[model samples]
Target chain A: MPASASSIPDTVLVSADALHALAVRVLLRLGLSQAHAEAMARTIVAGQRDDCQSHGVYRLLTCAQTVRSGKVELQAEPVVAPTRGAVVRVDARRGFSPLAFERGLPALVEAARTQGLAALAIHQCFHFSALWPEIEALTAHGLAALALTPSHAWVAPAGGHRPVFGTNPIAFGWPRPGPYPFVFDFATSAIARGDLELHRRAGTPLPAGCGVDAQGRPSTDPLAVAQGAMLAFGGHKGSALAAMVELMAGALIGDWTSQESLEFDAGAQAAPCHGELVLAFDPARLAGGDPAAGQQSAERLFQAITDQGARLPSQRRYAARERSLQRGIAVPRALYEEIEALGG
Target chain B: MPASASSIPDTVLVSADALHALAVRVLLRLGLSQAHAEAMARTIVAGQRDDCQSHGVYRLLTCAQTVRSGKVELQAEPVVAPTRGAVVRVDARRGFSPLAFERGLPALVEAARTQGLAALAIHQCFHFSALWPEIEALTAHGLAALALTPSHAWVAPAGGHRPVFGTNPIAFGWPRPGPYPFVFDFATSAIARGDLELHRRAGTPLPAGCGVDAQGRPSTDPLAVAQGAMLAFGGHKGSALAAMVELMAGALIGDWTSQESLEFDAGAQAAPCHGELVLAFDPARLAGGDPAAGQQSAERLFQAITDQGARLPSQRRYAARERSLQRGIAVPRALYEEIEALGG
Candidate 1:
């Protein structure tokens, strides 16, 4: 057993390294190939490092159960192929979305070189966990990227009793002259089910209008929200956006929308394959051959905001990240114990 | 006077062709060259046909006034150039956004052929009018597109007393397998000024939570909404989206941002040029020669809606367009008289 596994539950000092390694081991035990296991582990671990516990290792146990139940494929490679221009299509073959993204990003990034802006849409893939990282990767390459995804389960259409829509998220990032990209990633829903779960666990009331009860009336109890449908952020507009994502990803990419009754055959456990679309543009394409000039232009704008005494969008999140990094990743004591007991 | 213009009293029953021609005549009368006048006319006509009355011929008077003041260069040509890949930049030179787009579209279309997607950002340009027409035009060529423009004069930042943001609008369209593309265009504001004006004219009550009074308290009076700052759609989220558009169009394009003083130059009714960003993509590339198939799959999922049997987002809009076309465009009596006055 790893030495760190012995020290798991007693203190609040879980090293990021230990978490990553453990996650990787768990993935391997769940039958992922070595490379894929490592990739999935890193993505989820990074999510936790960024304080996205809902998308992080906390979901790994569910993922494992899903895998054992034959829902998610642990060792499937994406079918990546080029079509026209800088566009590429990937059929995930019931594989993990992170794996699909890992395979597709290189091609999409390289395509941006010749196309100025490139796009990729993946169908038949499971959750990629977090959108920010995918967009952040493009930003690292000095590209402004936007990504959208549709879900296979867990949400309903607005004004409808049946679950027919996914939370459907949108992620966008613009490369800045600063150390980090200006990134915005959010679901069209008022709040994520994960957050509801967290509040339910903590016995906290949800913010008003976040969700509805099973009967579709406004409810503040997190547990009811978890069991019932989540409302779109605003009324019609938010629903329109979520519906747009459904059309863009599920419809445009040729995936099963959540509205279709779950097929319980060979493909039933074949990872509730969702749909994803990514668009990345190179800013240099418009900066008159002087990449530095575009950077300066963006910098000046940022300076204007700072000088005018306005805060950047992710400033608070960045601060939280810094604090967590300085200390260590936080985890519940019960969770750490459970992870230790599940060690293969 | 055109003979057909006489039959409609509190209205103008002009053909699309007739309207375009008259718009060109008006622009030329305001000192624009024949070609620039035609380009601007076509754009405005397109907006009218698309039902974007607010940005259509409704603004002709203001545009004429601006042109007379030499705030808008009547015959100025946009400086069109390429960026890295399929990116084009147009220095509008205080020209109309439509003219900027007209000069920029050919290159962008060409870029889309080889780049999968083309992105164009116009700096120092006047209002582009309704975004739907631009999107509609692109969709005519079987492309998916999105356009964003930051209006700097009419919206308030979240939790702020003064209007520091524009009703900054975001427009996105996708070519479905059906007759018309799915287009969604709306301002980040709770309600557009035109909608409020309509409410005021009809003596209708404004929707709650849509606007604030002079003292910054929420108000349901359309008049108050017009006089005071409009609320954002979904509180913090909508505010964030508006801020994003400002950053993308104004800051990224080196135009302007809300963080700067809203008052540009008094007596300068000529507002500083706004920034416009347009993105065009070919879904066929990402769909791998199967856009129709993908769209079909999406339709199945979307149509499974248990609410009203799965309706498309633009279904109502399309039906409205069809009805309008069949019954002739419905114009308010006051607006009809207003345009008739323009002719005189």
Candidate 2:
């Protein structure tokens, strides 16, 4: 099939289907179970759907290579069980995150229904792109949710020279009365480490303080940022947030901090250790039988704001989702060519 | 007793007692209940001990004024109950946060034990000082936790002005192998609004792109940052995260967005519509009688990093905590004089 160029200038967009097919093939070729491959592929495709191409098909090659090298186990199955006080812990057994989360969330949901809320700590898992989709699953069931994942590399501690933490993204999803629910997700780093790769490929300059040079001083060179380390967002505050996620996701799950787990040299590999922390709450617990009424109040408040010309959170994304669905999800020729090459 | 004229240097150490006494007096004079005054005072002072001065007694004057204007119902009692799910909600009755949280957390604790994890959402609450302490309370029971709060003002949506959000902050804590567990809390703004206030008072300059003028142009002038609006920490991503908090903390709780909640003038009293989200999980649920073993693994992992001369999250605050406990908490002379002027 002929490839189409991405409409987003400077960005190469690939069709979700093409990306998913390539990702699944790569994962399977790397020895992942068919189910795991499909799940991982879907996750990667979701990232692209949400304009997170850096985490989408772009990551497939690296993920496949990592798995093939045994840096991320492909055959592992998560072992999930109930913990004290409504907590559920999943020993991901060093598998992909979707498998762990899929196994863990049911337990959390069951517990939350009985206990009013629940938490799941999935330890020793591989990456899951775009947390919003993960948390959105819970929000769909009337549960408000938050998720945190600690990465294996690319952040520095405050005032420190060396990279010692992950970008450490936190994501939250809440059901609202709007046409679409509001969701927010972000990394603690000033810029996602994935951007470093894009910058490297495109020969673009990075924003200052996004990362450090070889000497550990701040730099705007993508190569240095990738090789040295990414800086935390908001200086001390961002560092603190990153550090917090390390404790919550890494420490709680008995995984090494991203800094310690990093294998910077291309030939080096990270240990099979990563974790995610998920918390779920049913807002019905707060609104009683009057959720509709409470939502009405919220709608009224936001309507007042809209009356003043303010847009609601996720409004743009909601619009984009509709447009994308209507337009059959556009794919750029450049990204499609890359995917074709990888698949071949 | 005559006030001591001694200076605490870069560290303005004050005894916990003196700080609490002064804080209580100020709140009481501003019309808070004795119990509310005490809780608020302790929570605020606790942040000072943790070196979270921005969220500590530093905001006392604002709270006092907030209470004075009847925006905050000083004696309001929270309404707590379980909803359809095991979830618990606390209506702050438009009161101060410490009191509201003190009322809400117990419900969350009870709910978490049965649910394995539970979330407490407190709505219409005034400012809560330093989210770490609230998470600390959960950790005391050996529970890992996450907490988030929305500030009342001084942040803008990405590429837009008009102070549409606050320096929303998030905190996460985990229990570990020592007397001090890991705790991290920080704002999502490039700089805290309080820092801008400090700059305004001290005649200092802000780092570039910290905020923008009223016309939505970037500025390094602290005064403008205050009167105009601060930018989200990492541009688009940070803005998205803050928007998520708005839904979780504001819309979910039936409050308006920060922009909508603002009263006419920027500095004048705005409607106190802040909300908090808390999640707690017990590690034992997943440990299966091997809590210590899991903790040991986590401890070893953290120790390995520290052995390499890497600092753990909150290490500096823990050090400050010890120093304060041993040397007595310090109070700035100016603050001391200000407290004395309150005739405590």
Candidate 3:
């Protein structure tokens, strides 16, 4: 849907269902419960539909390897603890993050309804997918939500050379009375590591301020940046945001910081266990005693932006989803074969 | 404290108390009540102590003029309405934002303690100061806080020509068990409008991607950018954040959007009325029933960053505050005289 690998002669077209079934079969072979496999497969397919190939089947092989390595507990069930009236904590027991989220989100939404606002902290899980889906799910329940998580270290501080922070991503969702929710997710780094890797694969130069060379000099060479470190986007502002995410997702959740993640990754090839923070706000309770008024306000704001010819965040993803639903997903033939072999 | 205009030879040193008294006197002359004047003056003095010169006395003259022009109600009191168990809405009665915050923050804090999380929305107010102080107040009461506010539109959306978004600022505060809370505040724009005005005054070139020229072309000329529009930081990512802030502070609060503010400002030189959204989280309640564990985790995260020789956000402001507290604030001679004259 988003300019597939047309240059590759071995590109293949597959239906979304087929892709999902293949992913489930491969994950099932690698020792995952039917439910867990189905959950992970749905996320991967959604990523493909939304044009985020890096988060799609591109990571399936690695996911299978990680599970095979036994670093991720195949049979793990999250322990959800409601620590307070509006605070929910989920210990993922070193399992998949999606399952933890699935286990805790309903309770989190319920808490928000009762207390006006609620927070969900998920720790000891491998989160290797796009965050939008999780926040999107909250919006589906007519709530405003924010989600943040830290990954393995790749980004450097604004002025410093070494990588000290993760390419931390933050996502927000606002539910209007309209048909769809307004949502967006982005990494705090100048460029996502996946994009940098794509540039390297294409033999393209990176943009200015994207990353630095080994000598701590700003470089446009993707290889040099890959070898050195990525810079935080927008200089100090992005660095500050990355730091905030570290506090919220890592420290507040009592989970691994970027440094800790790196240390853990040093001894294993599996994805490092991470943490997530999700916040839900009940508009009916917070919007001056009338939720309809709040929804109308959101509608007016969205109209104002669209009137200015300004594209809203996640518009492209939604467009891609529409196209993918009609045309099916495009997968590279080589990758398809690899997945097929894994299924067998 | 922050390398004041000592090179200008006309810089004057003023004690913090004297500065506060002078600001209060000037505002009192402009028809603000004693309580309102004191509240406004405290914010001004705090801005100076923290080295936020643009938010300090530099903007006091404009504020007085706006209030005199009847754009800001001088004697109005904020009306606090508890919409739900943990949500409060403060209609500022078209008065000052600081007063609205002062009126609602106590209830908001109490709600957070009772329910683990709470939100406060303030609308119909003139907000012309740094947001850190309000969030800092929450931290002082041992709460983690987040605040956002929208201003008059000046920034262009990503990949768009015309200005459609405000330089919406977001602030976050984490109250550690340490002596000081970790806090950071930043505008979503590539640079704060105040700093851009400073660059224009100095005839300096803007940084890459800071803004665009009159033709919607990216320009480093501060004057051209002044004539045109500022760009969002980190391109699309920052634009999305600015949009999120517009929704949270503008739509969610049922207040004027940035475009509405601009329309209102079109007929006058007064500062546009804006809105603010503040959220408080009680760490003791939300941090898995063990507040000390949360504190230790935060300390570890901070140490990890410091170990890389990377400076923390607001480290400079904290340092400036220490120096200003010890040696008093520095003011330009002409500005000092202007304030002294206004007080009379």
Candidate 4:
């Protein structure tokens, strides 16, 4: 493989399949089981294909370090409890979450189909992947889905100085008639931890209100925020949402809170071990009128969004996906070389 | 009831029972049926008792006008479809939503108890009350609840200049071992439409980003924003949430979108008649571990929030409630006179 210097500079153009194969080999070499490797690879590839670089191959570095830190059970088998009474439980046994989600998704889809709504709870997993993938999974089954999960405690409550809450992302997906679903995944925090880390690595100043220093004064220094705390987006409202995620995905699910997850990390900065809550709704079953009418109604909302030049939540991602499929993804050549070397 | 002049000035001290009686009488005088009057009265009194002024007796003025406009079914009875497969459906018959919700709460509670999680879809109602009462209803049952509803299209989507979404509110309540359930109900818009109207009436300027002018330029003029569009909180994330509410509470329930609701009003500006979605989760049924452990976990999160000097959402409201219970609510003398005149 060679860098595509013909058009783009310092970028390697690689097919999705080739990237998946490389990711799988890398995961396998790093000690993941076959199922785990494939699930993880698929998620990473999807991130790349969708141009969500934060969740793409950049994640491999942290994952590899996490495995080396003796924190993750790379080959652990996930156990799924049979779906009943609108709840689907999957015990990830302290392993990576992707494999557990894959095992539990079918039962979730079936339950939602039968009951009009269903919940999927995955326990004790390294929940490092973006929630959009999980949400998109349900959307693909023609279901509306909501996904929530806690992360390490690096964000402060709206009016507080200390970090007690996680980035705590909430994701939602609505099924539509076309290839793309109306999708959005956003952190309750002012900014995602990954983006903060990116700024830290590049020695860049954060946007105002992104974080506070150790003394609780607002600061743009990513390093200071890394040492102190990130602020919740939209102030108090976003903070309330973060608390909701913590309570629903953490306490309600009988799992660790962000504070607990951080303590478990012991300063390793590894993937946060926690649980996830995914709720799916079958529109055809849930809607009282004709399902087609509901779908048409959804289409009108989307069209209205575009008509006003307001982009849908995942519009850019879908556009990037199309471009990637046609012209292959553009990965920084240096990063590509580094990822390739990780397989050895 | 005579005005209590011992401590507070320019106020009339009225007991909850007395206030309820007055509100009920006023609602009935406005042509509401007994059941509708009682339900609306209870909600209005609850707001006053909680010190939530926006939802208190101030709402009676609007309720009276709406009834006069023939927009509400003063004597209509809500129909409840029995719980089936985690779904509890209610038809509000174009009446007030409070009564419909009251009718469906029991079925939703039963369904959640049986299925671990359940959804209540209330269709075609004049949803003029605050959502906190509906949320508290579920939390009182030891269930975690999430409620969403769309109002008139007075807000713009993020990045767009046109009004297309509503001041859609998302309310959540989590049960705890305390006097108050952890509760938060906030509009997806930068500020509630009621607050904007208040600012306009008071000749006060709005905070930056609260809304835009008729030309879509950022403006602090509440009247201009009223003529144009209100902005969503936290920018795009809040906008995305507002869209979700429109789809779920509107399209998914086969009811009316904010745009549709606005069009239906035909510039009447009456209460936006639409649907609502309330999802409940029975903690014991949903938890993978001992139910007590889950409860304790929730308690810990609450404690942590307070320990960090951060006040939980609705803390002030709860405190106000305790004060109101001990020493009757203090109503402004002029408003008390106004309400009494309306009842006559």
lDDT (Cα, tens digit) per residue for candidate 1, span A1-344:
32232344543445788888888777887788787777788787777767676767776786776677676667887888864676777888777888888888888888876666778888677775778889888988888788998764456556654455677788888787556677778878888766876899999999997777777777889888767777778766777777777766666556656544145323444335567888776666544346565556456544544553555556665675675577776665666667666656
Q: Write one digit per residue (lDDT tens) for candidate 1, span B65-116.
A: 5665566777778899755566778888777778788888887777765666
lDDT of each candidate versus the true structure = 0.70, 0.70, 0.82, 0.90
State the lDDT of candidate 2 residue by residue for B1-344, as single tens digits: 33442554534566888878878888788788998998889887887777776667766766756755656777887888654344667888778888888888777777656655666777767765778889898888888887877676568777577676668776777786567987777677888766877888999999897898877788998887777888888676777677666656665554545644564225557335566778776666544445665576556545544764667667888887897788777666676566667645
List where candidate 4 sits over 4 angstroms from the true fold: A2-5
Docking class of 1: acceptable
* Candidate 3 backbone clash number: 0
lDDT of 4 at A313: 97
- The candidate scoring highest on lDDT is 4
Q: Cα RMSD (Å) per model?
A: 4.2, 4.5, 3.2, 1.1
TM-score of chain A of each: 0.86, 0.85, 0.92, 0.98
- DockQ each: 0.41, 0.34, 0.53, 0.79
Q: Can you rank all candidates by lDDT, best first?
A: 4, 3, 1, 2
How close to the true structure is residue A344 of candidate 1, measured as C-alpha lDDT?
Answer: 64
RMSD of 2: 4.5
Q: What is the lDDT, from 0 to 100, of the residue A195 in candidate 2? A: 76
Winner on DockQ (1 vs 3): 3
* Inter-residue clash pairs, candidate 3: none
